[model samples]
Target: MVKRTALYVTLVAGAFVSVFPYLLVALTALKTPRQLSGTEPWEPGLPPTFANLDRVMHSGFAGYLGNTLLMTAALTAGQLVFTTFAAYAFARLRFRGRDVLFWLYVATMMVPSAVTMIPLFLIMRELHLVNTWWGLLAPYLLGTPYGIFLMRQFFRALPAGLEDAARIDGAGPLTILLRIVLPLSRPALGTLAIITVISSWNNFMWPLIITSGDDTRVVTVGIAGLKGSIGVDPNQMTAAALIALVPMVAVFVAFQRYIVRSVVLTGLK
Candidate 1:
């Protein structure tokens, strides 16, 4: 009984430690300037203020949020299409040099994106895609090495009897994939969607380097600009950051079970 109590205490303590910073930020974002300057760091304002949220919403943060949403959706759709097809082929289709090709493709995952960033930029510049939406999306839209590897593993682990039965029913490869494989792989797909959304939404460096115009600027870079630009207050900055964090939090809340289930099914630590 004592050990169980201690374990619950530890878990509660750890959760509080993890959540305390965000709680502070929320408090700060809602406090009036006078209250914020005068009060203890952890103290809540006598009454909360919405002026920070109003200011941030008016400062073109909405545009950045829209851009991020569009980019995330496009990247997620493209990733699902390419990753699903490629993973299915690698797992099910018998082709010459298949193993060799898959391993060679997987080897690219070891090569850090920073190493290739400059070369990729130069190619984009040569093609006159710099400062364009296409430039931002083109590099990642095809799918990622990690995404391919994850889906491929899940596909390979599926029951072969299902595929064999489908084949006997005159189902072509596409039919089998669409009707049997994909429907059964919903958990893995949901996991990939969450991963793609989080990565694309949080990506800052690549978007900052690739595009300079506000027209294509993402929320991550926009949040950084809130910090550096003249006359932007800390409360507003915190508010903008909190706004950006809400969607991701919502996504995880909705699909968290899929992520846990996929991890268990894929045997990933």
Candidate 2:
């Protein structure tokens, strides 16, 4: 009984440590500037107001939101398409030096993005894509070695009998993959899509360094600007930060079951 009580206590403590900061931010959004400055950072404001949220709504928040959504959706879709095709070929197709090429590609994951950021920036500049949405999306548009490796692991885990049975029924490789392999892989796909969305949505450095104007400014960068030209309004910044979290939170909540399921299945595989 004592051990069980201690375990529950530990879990509750851990949960509070993880979530309390966001709760503080959410409370700050409800406060007025005076209340935000006067009260403790995490204290819930009495008689909360929506003025900060209203102010943020009117201050180009919609534009930033739209830009973020577009970039995230485009990057995630492109990555999934390219990653899926490449992973399938790696897992199933026979070709010369296939293993060598795949391992070489996977090796790129070890190279830090910071190391390559400058060169990527120079390449974007050479192509005249700087200050453009395309530039913001360019660095990571085609997925990563990590993503390919993840999908490849999932693909390789599938039974060969499935493919062989389809082949016996006159199904081409493409048809077999599309009909059989993909349907069974929904959990992995959902998990990958969720991961891609979160990564793209939260990405800051490349977007910050590449795009300079409001035209291509993503929500992550746009919210940072709120700390400066918006008169450093803590209430507005808090509100914008809360607004920024909604989509990713919604996505994780919606797909959390699939994520857990995928994790378990992948472990078993």
Clashing pairs in 2: none
Best by lDDT: 1
lDDT of prediction 2? 0.87
Question: Per-residue lDDT tens digits of candidate 2, residues 143-234?
Answer: 78877887888999899999999999999989988999999888788778887888899999899999998788889998888877536877
TM-score for each candidate, following the candidate numbering: 0.93, 0.94
Report the number of backbone clashes for model 1. Answer: 0
180-242 in candidate 1: lDDT tens per residue?
A: 999998978989988898899999888988999889999999988887546867787888888
Every candidate's lDDT: 0.90, 0.87
lDDT at 229, model 1: 42
